[model samples]
Target: METSQALLIYNMASVEKCPETLTAVNASSKQLNCSIDTYGNNQYMCLPNAEKSSLVEFCYNGIMGIQVEGNCLEAKDGRVILHSCKKFLSGCPKKPFFNYDFYKYPACQHINLKHFCYESDPSCQALENSGGFNNVSNDNRDIMYGLIGGLLVLVILTIVIAGFINERRWKRWWWSFTGVGNEPDRKPDKTSGTTTNPGL
Candidate 1:
């Protein structure tokens, strides 16, 4: 997909993740910064590490009917930290402490981790391999230039033809008005043997 298309998908997914409440603060190649304030004091920012995480999560959850977690939530080095997920979780116990700071990898480990997605995400790879994003084919460019050139030539030809027709019309009108070539030929009268005005 093209960058604009991918960004559109990403934005759509971000909206769907929160549905009319998400706001994108900044979007760049390195990260997508977004925030949600609908949940009162529970306001939070969703920054996915990979460029296509929003698109991937949207496809996975909305289209594939699979539950995708840790997409918009925060993480460190592609691993979802406990504190980050806890903010969104409700009625969860806090007494039982775990040694590990990050949650265990999900079954779809490849998709859940941001680093893995960045490196080997199928959608992004397909988009890149298809030469659709940020890449233009030479043939398409050449065709565009050819069409422009043809149109320019057509315009010039039409102007030239119009000018030629106008020039001919002007010459005919000037000749008629000035009597430059419409004067009757004078001839000597044989009987009189001299040229003479009939009126005189």
Candidate 2:
């Protein structure tokens, strides 16, 4: 069986695990030092695209229906600081951050945007319970494989049955042709008390 691949988790537990500095705006713009640690095993399922020139963090909080909290990033005293975090729908019709969306993963279906928090958060204690996109994908793949395997088995069975029937016919033909220890199709006529062609 093929092993299933796990989804990537962006753990911001420590500075080493997280990006030390990200471009505040664009690659050409000033770099911002990251310090937005919730200190509760900051595990992020999805993150904003760093390639964009804007400095914004997308946090999912389920206050309304699947809200995405947009926290503006600012450089203060040579360090990056979260200016303000606001709530928006998961769809983020305004497109809060540059290409920041959370509905991309199927696992997001089970996770409430508002309940999303640091690993230490009580609401996130059951984070593992939330199914992942890979899990769903793997399930679908397994079902497809099962159906294909069943079809193959059925085809093989049909072929084997056909071969068996053909083999029986072949054996009968061979026995008749070779006449090996088998009676001939024609027998002597008893009424004439002599061996003669049965057809005659």
Error of 2 at 172 (Å): 2.2
Q: Once superposed on the true structure, which residue ranges of model 1 sit more than 4 Å away at CA?
A: 1-48, 51-71, 74-76, 81-136, 181-200
lDDT of each: 0.35, 0.36
Q: Per-residue lDDT of 57-146 in model 2, one digit per residue for the tens?
A: 322221111222344322222222332223323322233432122323212222233344323323454553565554467779899889
Residue pairs in collision within model 2: 25-53, 26-53, 61-113, 61-114, 62-113, 62-114
Best by TM-score: 1
**lDDT, candidate 1, 59-152, per-residue tens:** 1011111112332222334332222223322322234422111122221122323233432335535555665533667888788789999999
Q: Candidate 2's error at 67, in angstroms?
A: 34
The Cα error of candidate 2 at residue 99, in Å, is 16
- Clash number for every model? 0, 6
Q: After aligning candidate 2 to the native by TM-score, how far in Å is the CA of 35 from where it should be?
A: 28
TM-score of each: 0.32, 0.27
- RMSD score of candidate 1 (Å): 16.8
Q: Total backbone clashes of model 2?
A: 6
